[model samples]
Target: MSYVQQVMEQAIKRSPNEPEFHQALKEVLESLEPVIAKHPEYEKAGILERLVEPERVIMFRVPWVDDKGNVQVNRGFRVQFNSAIGPYKGGLRLHPSVNLGIIKFLGFEQIFKNSLTGLPIGGGKGGSDFDPKGKSDNEIMKFCQSFMTELCKHIGADTDVPAGDIGVGGREIGYMFGQYKRVRNLFEGVLTGKGLTYGGSLVRTEATGYGLVYLMDEAIKDIGKSFKGATVVISGSGNVSIYAAEKAMQLGANVVALSDSNGYIYDKNGIDLKTVKQLKEIERRRIKDYLEFHPKAEYKEGFEGIWTIPCDIALPCATQNELNEESAKALVANKCFAVGEGANMPSTPEAVKVFHANKIIFAPGKAANAGGVATSALEMSQNSMRYSWTFEEVDAKLKDIMVNIYRNASSAAKEYGCEGNLVVGANIAGFLKVANTMLAHGVI
Candidate 1:
């Protein structure tokens, strides 16, 4: 068997029951065949084997008291996957679905994602299987404190700086940062996505979503296409989805749909992102609540149906594996020309294959959704200097970084004789940097 196949088999054998991590590894490793051939020294140094294994995995128990005086317990995890390039950097996701395997998958993806940003941050992810929905503010604060009490010991401003993910947002970050301060007794930039008053950077809120559109705008431009007057379908109603819709509409695309965990709302007249931001950001309501504002709009119960709305561009900004083979075929049948992932591994491997087969412009999450972490690095710089930039300044820098990411990925693809295949391009481009850094570090 080949080196890549050998690593795949061995990794799966050693780490069974981690299908998410396996899937992530498969996607990246398969794309590294050309790179591996070009550098047999990488195999000699066992870079592939070490790359898949995390440097450290921390598991702890979080015990907190709810508002009703009831004690609750949840398992917490932080997988510090790699730090060859720089310190560990990723997000802490809070949800009922969080587990070691899930965090591993996210951290594995983060290594490449952070590397693609050309920033001095490594890969790590931490979270718990705690559900925050419908929880009282006190309960959430207690839980955040408990989670950070342990997490703070393993991270630092210069060591591992975590941002927000899925259920963990400004509120959670605030609670955790406060707790980290109380526990460590030192206020520093240990986390990104902080409230603006507390060392947060501008443009951080809209980075990922806007960055996705920016990358897509660049990719489609190479093919004589743009978001101008194009029909766009974006999934998720959270920060990423809302901002992506906002930017796409600003760029003249008609955003027809946005969804949440419950269902999706479609408006052929173009989605009013103002109402969406109000509902999701302020009211914390479901997408169905959107119809209450616009009676003429349509709401569907199933999220999978969102892809069938027929659009020129589809941005999957939801959770992992949210888009499957069926959804991919549906989008292609509708003549969708581009699919940009605003979420980590939002599209399945099979779905990616379908897009490639149809000659669709597929921007992998590591490249397309990198704006969030890229901006997080920017936030880190601001924190280090005790200064912040204006919104326009940060946004301009973000756009430049995103454009460079697209150019680097495209150039990498062309160099590897796979021009127009951004999946391979992004993977190769991201891996080479980390791999060479690992080599320089001398098997540490």
Candidate 2:
């Protein structure tokens, strides 16, 4: 075993209960073994240890009054993992699954993901164990306000900037931003994913999904293939899945599947993106609602079944570990040539192994999903300049950034003797940038 791996194993042994931190460090160090061998300075500088452990993890209670005139409290967390490259930046997800483990894993991955974007942003993630679903608008607003009340103390445009993820969208961001403005008594760009009227950047909503498709385009191009007439099955109906489907369709790919937490829908005639947009974006309804517009579609009750359908590309834009070894085998069995992750660690290590063994073009989340944070960094840039670009301009920039990220990952993999292995490439590319920055800045 390499020295860095050994050190990480020891660290994991010391904190056995911290699964999120362990998962993050394991994935990162596994691909970085060769890097550590080449650069002993990383070990001497204790970069691995620092990278595994967040600089600060803040957890607090979010107490609020619901619309029903009852007091409720929720747990909140913010894992500020690193700031060597720039300030802490990541999204805030609102779901019952939010915890220290999830936040740490997200933050650790964010460090590398942000670095891969070639942006001047470090890594951080924050959220609360507050499920926004089934809540009245007033209830969600109250919860968001309470959550931001504690979060604003540690975030700013120049410090850590939070964006939207999963259950946290424009509504949640607006509530949180309002709370931050109320507390700080300033209208700064303290949070991203804001409404257009605020200091929000254009194309921020479509960045992650659009970026995923852009990366997929690069991957296919690397293999002398293209998305033209390709069939794609994408899991999750959230922002990432939605925009990914839209962009893939625009690129001449037929997207046949999309899902939510409950289940997925498969339409052989290709999913109607406009219908999906109305159901998900406007009505905030379930994926099953697509049947109302397209009755011929098949609605399956679980997301796991999405893998059974045959397709040329698979994009797991859902939650972490959504794709397991069985799903990976299914994709390979069904002749899937490309898989891009739009969610953080959406594929398990075993699934990744399966894809690697099959020689599939697999792009890791740290690189594929880096577009969200990259656009957040763009939002930060606009905020710094007090200027907002048009939607077309911001989208053009996002595409360029995603293309560059794929090139960087591809080049890093080739240099590290792992050509065509994006997991290794992404880890090395991101780690080198952060490690070099940390070394240059000295131990903090």
The number of the candidate with the highest lDDT is 1
Q: Which parts of model 1 have CA positions greater than 4 angstroms off?
A: none
Model 1 — TM-score against the truth? 0.99
Candidate 2 C-alpha error for residue 155, in Å? 1.0
The local distance difference test score of model 1 is: 0.95
| Candidate 2: tens digits of C-alpha lDDT, residues 48-75 | 8777878998999999998879999999
Would you list the clashing residue pairs of candidate 2? none
- Candidate lDDT scores, in order, read 0.95, 0.90
For 118-216, candidate 1 gives per-residue lDDT tens digits of: 998999998999999899888999999999999999999999999999998899999999999999999899999999999999999999999999999
Which residue runs of candidate 2 sit more than 4 Å off their true CA positions? none
Q: After superposition, how far is residue 208 of candidate 1 from its true place, in Å?
A: 0.4
TM-score of each: 0.99, 0.98
